[model samples]
Target: MARADALEKLRETLINRRRALVRSATGELNQLQGRSAKTGDLLDAVAESLQSELNSQLLEAESRELTAIDDALERLDQGEFGKCEACDRAIPLTRLRAVPYAKECIECHRASVKRRSHPAATINRVFDSYQRAQ
Candidate 1:
């Protein structure tokens, strides 16, 4: 398909996803707020607390995705969608379809993930260097 057509399709997908996330988040918020802390016993209270925590985590993830979707929409409007932010390369249609809000191409995204996953290693290397200098 043409580039414009592809982007339009992705835009529709993003909008639909945004709407779904909003609906889900709103429902989760209402449920979280409407739940009562008081329960019949300690076990029930613990279960309620665990459920509330899980809901909070899901809501947080949804909120982050909503922000990313909003950013992707803005990029689409600005004629910058489907381009990797890190490498200035056009992200593949397949990747875009898989992750509508992806900001980087596969290579760049993998590198970013690697970097993120090895922060402790980086820190250890730095410490080793500092120790050698001392």
Candidate 2:
């Protein structure tokens, strides 16, 4: 398919996902709010609290995804969609299809993940290299 056609399809997918996330988040919030603090027993109370915590975490994740989708839509409007934020390269269509809200291409994303996973190790390596050069 043509690039424009591909982007339009991705836009539709992002919008649909955003709507679903919003609906799911709203339902979760309502369910959490409807729950009472009082329970029949300590065990029940603990279970309720755990469930609430899990629901809150899910809502948070959904909120993050919603924000990503909105950002992607904004980029689309600005004619910047499917361009990697890190490398300024055109992200592959397959990657975009799998992750409509992806901000970076696969290589950039993997590097970012590696850095995040071992910041201390990366810093140590950098320091060691600097020391060696001195």
Q: What is the C-alpha lDDT of each candidate?
A: 0.80, 0.80
Taking all chains together, each candidate's TM-score versus the true structure is 0.84, 0.84
TM-score, model 2 to reference: 0.84
Clashes of each: 0, 0
| lDDT (tens digit, per residue) of candidate 1 on 54-116 | 888778767777888899999999999999999899999988876788888989977887878
Name the weakest run of 10 consecutive residues (lDDT summed) in model 2. 118-127
lDDT of 2 by residue, 4-87 (tens): 789879999889878877898899998799779465788888888898998997787677667778999999999999999999
- Worst ten-residue run, lDDT, model 1? 118-127
TM-score of 1: 0.84
Q: Candidate 1: deviation at residue 54, Å? A: 0.3
